[model samples]
Target: MATFFGEVVSVYSRAVEEDEEEEEEGEEDAEIRREVQKQREVHLNWRSEIAESIESSSDKTFQCSDLVIAVGQNASGFLSAFVLSTGNWDVVGTVTLWNERTKGPSQVTNTQLPEESRCVLYRQAACPSVVICQCTYYVAEDQLFQWTEKVLGSIQRRGLRVLVLSDCSVAEYKTSECITASPSPFLRTLKTSEYRDALRCPLMEQPNILTGLPAAVLSHCQVHRIPAVVYQCYSDVACPDSLTMEAYRPALSCLSSKLGKVDYNPSTEVLRKVVRVSEAQSNLYT
Candidate 1:
């Protein structure tokens, strides 16, 4: 090739041109991955009134004393059947997130009640400082740390106490005894050093560890020097059952005074309704 000034110029081979094109494509692929990660980021969406309140607050965060989180089917069902059934609580906010496992609405929808959403926040009218989060969504492993940070970051750390309720399979629990001899639907606790309160259940023994959102939350609290504890229920049932949900009753005994005196043991009708709803949702073969 020759320039307009008559100076000789060399033309690159097709191989070089193809290599340049490949480099450009790689850059484009990198940009796409970055955008996808941004989309998968965790987010907490508060109701209009709550948003305004937080904006008006001096700390720009929710003033919480006791933040109770119920994660998984049985744990959330326990809240639904016993505590939330009293109808003294109001939906204050929700968690909006997207990941590979999320199949429900990505954002809060007016058609569905807060309780029906994947992760919903509720506040007791009698005790505004006490908040309950019922999370039913599947939070992927990569997203757990982010989810914990976003959720706890929104609440004021001063005078904050966190309690996490979660359920797992009995098979996950480690014991030397026969599986049939071991108690099913039993509670085990894990707490941070900052947490000085007496636990209702026995501490989780060594050689056993926690994972998922509960572990993430506890780890965050431990590092931040926040008082937090998790009450994990190990159940044998593949589906949520009233017995499994009842296993968490003792865990909330300490919170009764703060949450107001409501019946911890809900009527059988309420239990049936809550269990039926969870069973319907989790029954893939039906």
Candidate 2:
């Protein structure tokens, strides 16, 4: 009878121990769930803050007094410096355009920089150093000329001196096909005497001038008097307007002092005026 009692006590003790272990495990699971929930909340809050910041930034205004614009190609560093230099000053619509590669070579847009040769040539007109790599480019002559006119026109409109740097290899250019093609745009735009002068400028006389893409670009710039310089694979080429990081902060401070902030006024006011006039005419007819 005593042995039977001892066996019952042992079984009861084991049951109690198992129950406690289960309880401990349940608590640990609950703690783990809490941690996961906390992390999720933090992540969501961070995302919300980022979204709000973006929305606020879009409507932000800045002072536009005493604006100094700098234009260039492949000069992200310079552009950033310029921005930092003019802190609190309105820098809306700065940094005109850079050569952005489209999805594929075959995809041509109205403003797509034509052949790789023409692309570098365009940059050379604006920037001092241009690097050309050997690559196949497909663009029609007329489109290329038209795009060139637009780019040059932008420079004239902005009244900004631009320096560009292109970094590509000399071996990449395909020049023979481009050289023989008629530059009819030049013929149309240039006066007879000016066209004669441009033709005399090294490009026509030099054999395989198109093969040396930088030389061709400089020759063209020479004809137009656009103040261009070309350098091959070298950053040592001096740009007087190179903005240093140290000077950037001070420049911004100066700009802030000179130009107070102003709100961006859209041309929608003109449309509003037109609508009001139309409404008045309709009321008179009524």
Candidate 3:
């Protein structure tokens, strides 16, 4: 090809150039996705003794009879004040994972350090069959299924009964009546088909579905024929308060024997500390 001045000009195909750029970008995007997924993968870390027991066990799973899980601020606070304060429980394992909402280090170096951990497992010393999981971090939607599977899979399913306590905003509750007219902090129950025990509260109403980790655990239990129950507390408080924490008392009452001596009537001072800590955490702008 020659220009009007008899000088030849080399021509390049714009379409080919654009295609190469897109191909390179597509590969880069795929690599980014792979890295993100790897970071998001959930890992279950058990204590040395617990890991050894699991490995030596015939079933290769921890033998658990009662697994109680508290998911959210109010639920976890309730357990911290009433159940865990009993001083008969020991930290056994932890779940480590990273997500978009994760803050600070995701891997916990010391299981005893609760302040540094997001999800932790505690087992009763007197009754080893009973285990409690306190999860105070956000588990993204995509990670919920895997989180539930790994946590539940590690525990023996035979004769296992799971109890989950979770909290949601009162605004999320569906009702015809005014939400303020009804109780601000109340308990609604959901149970798997295999759970034949009497509920501590009314069943969750239709068209009002549950999401997040509690729902994920219940769904897994339902599918696996495991006896599981969830008590969801609807609270108006923006942060965890004593009232919201106390709303879960009835749910814990059903498992009183398994939980040992729980301080159902926690002292006012104890309650204040719980509420104060939550309020301090909530005070971001101040």
TM-score of each: 0.87, 0.25, 0.87
Candidate 1: worst-modelled 10 consecutive residues by lDDT = 105-114
Q: Candidate 3 on 1-286: residue-level lDDT in tens?
A: 6788998755576568888999999999999999888778888888878888899999999998999999998998998888887767888888888887865355554333434466889987887888889998889998998899889998999999999999898889998777766677998989999999889898999778889999999999999999999999999887888888988888767668876678878889888988787677668896
TM-score preference between candidates 2 and 3, better one: 3
Q: Is candidate 2 or candidate 3 better by lDDT?
A: 3
TM-score of 1: 0.87
Off by over 4 Å in 1: 1-26, 108-115
Question: What Cα-based lDDT does every candidate model obtain?
Answer: 0.86, 0.30, 0.86
Write the residue-wise lDDT of candidate 1 on 122-240 in tens digits.
Answer: 99887899999999888988789889888898899999999999989888999777867657989999999999988898999877899899999999999999999999999988888
Clashes of each: 0, 18, 0
How high is the lDDT of residue 222 in model 2?
58
**Candidate numbers sorted by lDDT from highest down:** 1, 3, 2
The root-mean-square deviation over C-alpha atoms between each candidate and the true structure, in angstroms, is 6.4, 26.5, 4.7
